[model samples]
Target chain A: MDDNLMNKLAILAEGAKYDVSCSSSGVERLNNGKGIGNARGWGICHTWSADGRCVSLLKLLMTNSCVYDCSYCVNRLSNDVPRASMSPEEIAMLTMEFYRRNYIEGLFLSSAIEKTPDDTMEKMYRTLDLLRNVHQYNGYIHIKAIPGASSDLIRNCGYLADRMSVNIELPSRESLKLLAPQKSFEKIMPPIENIRNNILLYKDERKSFKKTPKFVPGGQSTQVIIGATPDTDRSILSVSEKLYSDYGLKRVYYSAYMPVNEGPNLPSLFSAPPLLREHRLYQADWLLRFYDFSVKELFAGNSSSIDSNLDPKLNWALNNLHLFPVEINKAPLEMLIRVPGIGHISASRIIRERRVNFLDFERLKKTGCVFLKAKYFVTCKGKYDGESLDSEFIRRKLLNKMDYQQISFLG
Target chain B: MMDYLYDGTFEGLLTCLYYNFAKIKATGIYRTDTYQTSLVNPHVAITTKEQLADKMYEKIRKHLGTYTLTDLYYCFLSEKDGFENILLSFIDLCFRNGPVYAGYHTHKEVIPFDDIVGKVKREVQRYVGYVRFKAVGDVLYSEINPEFFILPMLASHFADRYFNEKIIIHDAGRSLALISKDGKHFIMPYTETDLPGSEKEDHITNLWKEYFQHIAIEGRINLKLQRNFVPLKYRKDLVEFSKPK
Candidate 1:
């Protein structure tokens, strides 16, 4: 209610708005009758921001006084912006108040590395401690793991938070050196590796024992700044694939870099954020995670960029035309999922629905399959709608459909 | 042609289904109001028989999986015109074909029923996000005018979530309220009454509006995408859309 606190809240929240990693809770924790809040597995989006992104958490920074000057960051030390810091108690109080009013699912506590990485992380840890122990709030909390924070500090905070993330802002080590002189892959990668090992260890222990006090039960994630330092989609997706495969990360967020802070290294102030590119990357990322796609298969014959005209699945399907014309009723689950416009849910539906009776084109439509693009690739009981097997024919039809439905200028 | 007429409730629909299964040939099952003007078919007024409804519900669970039972409930909740008849035909198909009916997405009888169920469930999911509660006296109150009668579906989620608080979630369109007090919850017909919001509620709401406006990045302002998620129909009661008094 204090005037000072309101200004601080505005400054801190504005600093934290660029983050896109707080959409889902991913952990389901029921209230133990005493706690003030409960975490649902599929997190609730309390409201959609004007930018059309979900505002699930009270995303705020502990302080906007940074020691490091990342080129893309609005809160870099060199930038002349209003600075503010909240006490751990103030943060906990604010989170509980917002949560009680149902304005937010929980807190997404990040910081500007005010004094040092460890110092900033410690303050965040204390805030989480205050929320959990002092306030008895058990909502979905996602806190940032400061890149250079010590393992012990990261471990201590992991116990209280549902999910933790360390943003790998730059795609490659070379880009990190060029744009963000202070950060390196070496500093960021270790905390992620440590969290993964501890999560695995805790999982094993919890299986044997009942009350292990869940350590980052929602798992860990990271973000990459797209369009910042000329990193190719291949380079970006390669890092994402590595994070998922090696570190066991739950998600890798792609933030279309907004040119907030201008520098020789950063994009021009007027250059549009590569939102469509970011969207395509997300589509490709989902393929990598869910559609059994490998980085090698995605960009065969040394292509680095994703197709601008088509989605990753359709692009891949067009390139591998020999594999298409898959019989809907007879095709296996893996093959069905690989087909363009057949998502995991619809693929499963097709598989289940076909066992009782043979699927026709009309039946496949009922299962929510994208018939426009899918008709070209799939044969329902040897009946194919697409006239030609030529890849150009299918591609042209899809492009025409995309033309009518394009929402943005990029399309 | 024989037409079955029943009160527009899930149990009433199920009771009609029971008679249809017991050698009563149904050209269609319509709500009593819907069947009143129909000229071609002879109407049978089906009473709310709890035993018959229970038997049909159990038979549905046994023949089809629990998923179909859920779909049946959702389809009934959809309240779309002719949805009851679609449910009857879908159930009849399931009864004849056994569990295989679930996999027959291509079947003429099954598609409409599944689509309605999906539509209703989708709306139920949206209401979970769209329902905004305001502090009113000792309890929180939220009112929704959703297309579907989602009060029964929304009740369990809100009860588990705000377990401690006494909350009233009113479906203004359906004139029903799912009220929770001391962890116990039930749904009943509710007429609109003036429930005064707390004095602090408006102040807190304004702060939230400020946060909402500030959070949106200036570079990305897509009204089409925002509207797709939070449609205009549901925006009337949401705090962010409300003009300050």
Candidate 2:
């Protein structure tokens, strides 16, 4: 019996690996003494896989069997791969055992459609229900909202899960039609919209009635496959920005498309994945979320992609050099963070340190700001540390410090 | 220059701080166990006094706030060579210049103090996830080999997490263990013995090893990046990194 379960686990985990949304953050739940686990607001990663991605949750699928055929998916109906499904009891047992041993933070449960969309959704819901109610597990759970599932079933799953996400697999509608022909914006967008509305309503209700159950307290997120289509970085980031502003998303994961099945519409199987481009997109995503940069600000000119050599923030600094040399001692928090090397942590540290003492060049270095890059952009106590304020000279100096060899396709 | 020696404990270090403030100024502070004899300087053995240490603790908390006190405690836990002198000088600077000096990250005395504290805190965070347990009868047992004395820091996090399970987290490097059961937890000195050999292979452990390998994308196999997060030192205790016998 155990051998059978292990085989199913290996198959289901392989099927779910491509979805790439394993974060267990944005929720803080304490174990109620009788339960087995609790969650921290800033999540913990149990271990990292060989690919260097954080294994914060036990990422697995309910079943590898599917009805729909998406060309990019390994578990699509037409693919000849090992097929298996785990009973809800088996999934709950594995999650509890792994979580008890500290092998994972929680369960990241997603599934390919075994039959209809509702059938897959119901099985996922049952697994969450068993873990939550039967096993009394209080750890983090991130579940996927299968597109075209019934609204009531999705709502029930949201209450048991910490986070819910609907994967907008392809960025553009045109790509969606050509690649994942069965899926569309019409099926994908509604569940995300419903989740956003319900999260707001539940939060407001909890304010009035403290006993009201939390509905997806970690908020919702989505993933988009990059390099699968010709979608520009501008368009991709704009979609993320709109999701943040409109849907109030917690995060938007961008997975570089890995060619699994050979198809006319897909990239050639032998071609390398666009790892560098994906890294650049993630950098821009961080700027949008924390550094107060807009999608428009990232791509200022006719260029459709972010600069390959420099990071988005440094690239932005090079384009808008007139804004520098920002005085470290007197610049506001907003302007200070925009400096090339000063991150949100260092920017706030500078603010606090300046309140007690006047920051000089030596003092600024001690605040943990990256002096190699920030020296060209920021002036400490009105002293310019760089040789010249010219953008070209500064860019050349900054590029020299970066290790260009690490920017290969495999990286 | 006078060298003061005390028992290696946070309370003992605080008493040394009390002596520096109220009694006599010392050039060097050393833990009693790790102190080396010096012909040039006269040594003073400062016994750990609960009253004196409590007074200094209250003074630091009242003036410097709880956060600064916590940082000082973390630094003491690091048990690094010459950390006692660094802590003394940092406390002296903070007291002389008021509480604002604690936030002076660029200051000479604050820099080394913050660095030691950061290492200790980071180790605590890493162990929170890296700790892997195996069921031995009713108790869940795990072992860790960390550079610093971080068992005290990890106590509350695991106690709240595994409140219902009888868990023992053994720190083999320091001969300490955090034992939690019945909704309460405490740290004490413990020595471990080898478990009796079981003929049967554990199925769950095998399943976790399989899942770890299957999760990584075959095309994006970067052992360099993997080692960056899970360093060579930590791989010994991790279940997935261990080769199956």
> Model 1: clashing residue pairs?
A353-B103
TM-score of 1: 0.95
Q: Each predicted complex: what DockQ? A: 0.59, 0.78
Model 1: residues >4 Å from true position, as ranges? A407-411, B33-38
Model 2 steric clash pairs: none
Candidate 1, B20: how far from true, in Å?
1.5
Residue by residue across B129-239, what tens digits does model 1's lDDT show? 778888887788888899988888987777777778888888887788999875679998998658886657765676677777778888888777788788888888688
Best-fitting candidate, measured by DockQ? Answer: 2
Could you give the DockQ of candidate 1? Answer: 0.59
Residue-level error in angstroms, candidate 1, position A36: 3.1
The TM-score, computed over Cα atoms with residue i paired to residue i, of candidate 2 is 0.97
- Alpha carbon lDDT at B212, candidate 1: 76
